[model samples]
Target: MASSGFCSLGPTVTSLFSSHALARWRSSSISPPPLRISRALSAATTVPISSSFTWDDVIETGREEYTPHNSSDLTGFLEKVNRCNRASEKLAEFIPFVIEEQIVGYIHKGFTEYLREFHDIFTFSQNGSCPDRVDGFVTLNLMLEKPEDRTRAVADVIKILGDKGIIPGIRNELYPVKPSFNAPVFFSLERAAAPYFGIKGYGVHMNGYVERDGQKFLWIGKRSLSKSTYPGMLDHLVAGGLPHGISCGENLEKECEEEAGISKAIAYRAIAVGAVSYMDIDQYCFKRDVLFCYDLELPEDFVPKNQDGEVESFKLIPVAQVANVIRKTSFFKANCSLVIIDFLFRHGYLLISPTISLSKETSYLRLYIPDFNALTLKNLLVLDLVMMII
Candidate 1:
C-alpha cells in the first residue's frame, strides 16, 4: 500500500531507480514559521466572511478523454528528471500511479524525450530526503496575461506535464468559454501520487466556508493576480497550505486579514465543516480535503476587507452562482470555481445537495472529459504542462 491514500501512485509506479534517496537525512535545518497570536483573536473574532484556502479545485469541463502525446517539451522534461538524488524515505515512498500501467510507461518515455530535446533549456534533479520528488518537479505558481494568456501559457504547460494528461476545462460559468469546448481553465497540473502514499507539498489550501444568510455560505478566498500562482484571479478562501508557520485554522485567520481584511472575530466563526485541504497543490492532486467552516454570527454591520489585493470585488454568491459562473464561463480558473460549485452541490449548498446528502458527485470529472478531446487534448496538453511547470 502507498503511504498516503491521497497519493495516486503505487508499487508499479516505481520511484526512479536512483539510489540517491538512500542518503541519510540531516534533520531539516530549516526553521518553521513562528506561531502567531492573531490566531487566538481569529478564533474569537467573527463577523463577515473572508477568503479561504480550502475551497479551490481542478476544472475538467469540456474535455472528452485523456490522450497521450509526443512533444519536445515533455521529452525534455523527462530527460532532466532522469537525474536526481532522493533519501531512503523518498525511495521507499510512493511514485505516480494510474490504473493503466501502460500509460505510465508511455508518459515516462514521452517526458524523457522532451528532456533530451530541451537539454539546454531545463535542468532536472531529484535530490531529496523523500522519494516521490525523484520523478516530480517542485510545484510553482505563476501568473499570466489576461484572457489571451492561452497563447503564451500553452508553451509553458507542455514543458511541465510532458506525456502526462494535462486536463483543461471552462474558466467561467457562463458556458461558452474561449475554446467553447472547455471553459477557459486557469488551474491544472501534472497529476500527483495519491495522498496515502506519503507524497506531500508545502503549499497552503484548506477546506473552509463563508457564512451568509441563515445557511453557511461556502466561502473560499480568491487568489490575488499578484500571487505567483493565480495572480489577479479569485480562488478559495484559504490557499497555498498555510506556509508551514501556522496551523490550518490559523491560516484561515491570516487569509481573512490578508485577502478580505475581515475582522479577527470573522476568522473564528467556526462551523461544522468537513475535510480540509491545507494547500492548493494538495487540492489539485487529491480531490478531497478537510478544513474549518462555521457561520460567523457577526452583526450585520460586517464589511469585508482584503490586504493582499486579491479581492478586487467580493460578493455573497449563492452556491448556484458557482455553477452559473462555470456554465456562463465567467470564472477565470476552473478548479477553485469547480470546487465551490461541487462543494455547494455535494454538501447541500445547492438545491440538489444543499446539506451533505452523500449521494452526490462533483461535475468537474464528467464535465472535463468531453472538453479534453483530441485537438483540444493537444491544446490541453500544452496548457496543462504549463499549468504544471513555468
Candidate 2:
C-alpha cells in the first residue's frame, strides 16, 4: 500500500517579443509601467493552486527546460515517491490488532485508550517487557467469535467515536478486515476508521489514456473543491476505495463509469498492470494501502464526463507534460503519484538505471505481474528491480 504528500508551485511564464514591441518599449520616453513588468514576472513564474499546480499554465512557461527528457528527472520523481512513504519512526507507537491469532491491523497506544472504554468489544493483552515494543495486542471479545457479532460490536463502538468526532468523515461504506487481500473476511469496518485502526486498506486507480499521432495523452481529472480529502487536486481518470464485497476488477469498472462515465465495454479493457504499497503514520492514523493499478486505452474521440460530482473537470494532457507536472509540482494527489509513476515506467517514459543507488530514506515497494502486455516481461522485471531499490 502506498500513500502520498501534496505540494503546489505557482504558475510559470516565458515571454517572447517581436523586434517591433521591443523597439517600441526601448524607444519609449516614458518608462515601461511597473505594472507591466510585474504582470510579466507573474506570468513567468508558476501559479500554485490549493492542492496542486496547473499543467497547462506551467507547461507553456517551459518549466520542463530544466530536465528536457523526462527520463533524466529521477531526482524529482524520487521526491514524489519519498512523500508517500513517511513516519516509519512512529511504528513503535502502535500494537498489533489480531483476530483468530492472526494480526490484521495496528492500534496506536494513544487511540487504544478509546478502545479500552469498550471492554465488551476489545480485549488487550500484555506480552512483553519493553514499553514501546509491540509488547501488547488488541483483539475482539472471544464471546463475539462469529464475524457478524464482531462486526456489529465494532460498528457500535465506531458510532460512539464518530459522535465524538474521533473518527470524522464516516463514509458508511464497509471495508473488509482480514490478514491479507485474499483472506476470508473476519468482519467489516467503516471506511473512514480503517486508517485510525491501522488497518490495511486497498483501492483501485486507473490511467485512462489515448494514443494520438504516435503520442500518448492521459485523461486527468480535477477533483471537486468540495471534496473532503485532497479537494481541487489532480487525480486519475478513475479511482476509488476497494469497499467490501467487490472484486478489484468489478470495483474498477464501477468506479470507471461513475467517476468518468466510461461504459463497461471500455472499462473492461483496463489491464491490471501492477500494485503499489506504502505504510504512513500521521498522528493516530496508520495508513497502510495497496493500490491496484490499471491502464485503459481510450479512443481519440472519447471525451470523459463525470457522472459523479466528485470530479469538477477533465483534460487530456500529453503524457510527457503530465510527467513534468508531477515532478515539478505537487498537483496530483500523493498516492496518485505512485500509480502514474508506475504507468511511466511501464510505458517506457521513465528510464532509471539499475545501478543508481537509492538512499535508505525512501520507503516504497511495487510488485508487478511478469506477463502484463503493457511492457515486456523483462522490462517489468527491470522496473520492479528499480522500484524495489527505492
Q: What is the lDDT of every predicted structure here? A: 0.31, 0.70
**Runs with alpha carbons beyond 4 Å of true place in candidate 2:** 1-49, 52-73, 128-134, 356-359, 370-384, 387-390
**Total residue pair clashes for candidate 1:** 133
Each prediction's TM-score against the native? 0.37, 0.80
Query: Worst lDDT window (10 residues) for model 1?
Result: 37-46
Candidate 2 C-alpha lDDT tens digits along 1-390: 111111111111111112233344334344222110010000012223356455566456324533234244355566666666556667767887889987788889999999999998899999743223437888899999899988899999999999999999988999999877667899999999999888888888999999988988899999998898899898999999999998777888899889999998888777666567666678999888877778889999999999879998998888888888776777888889778887877676664444333333334344433333323223222122343212
lDDT by residue for model 1 over 245-329, one digit each (tens)?
Answer: 2444565567657866666665565332222121112212322222222223334445556676655555444434443333333
Largest TM-score belongs to which candidate?
2
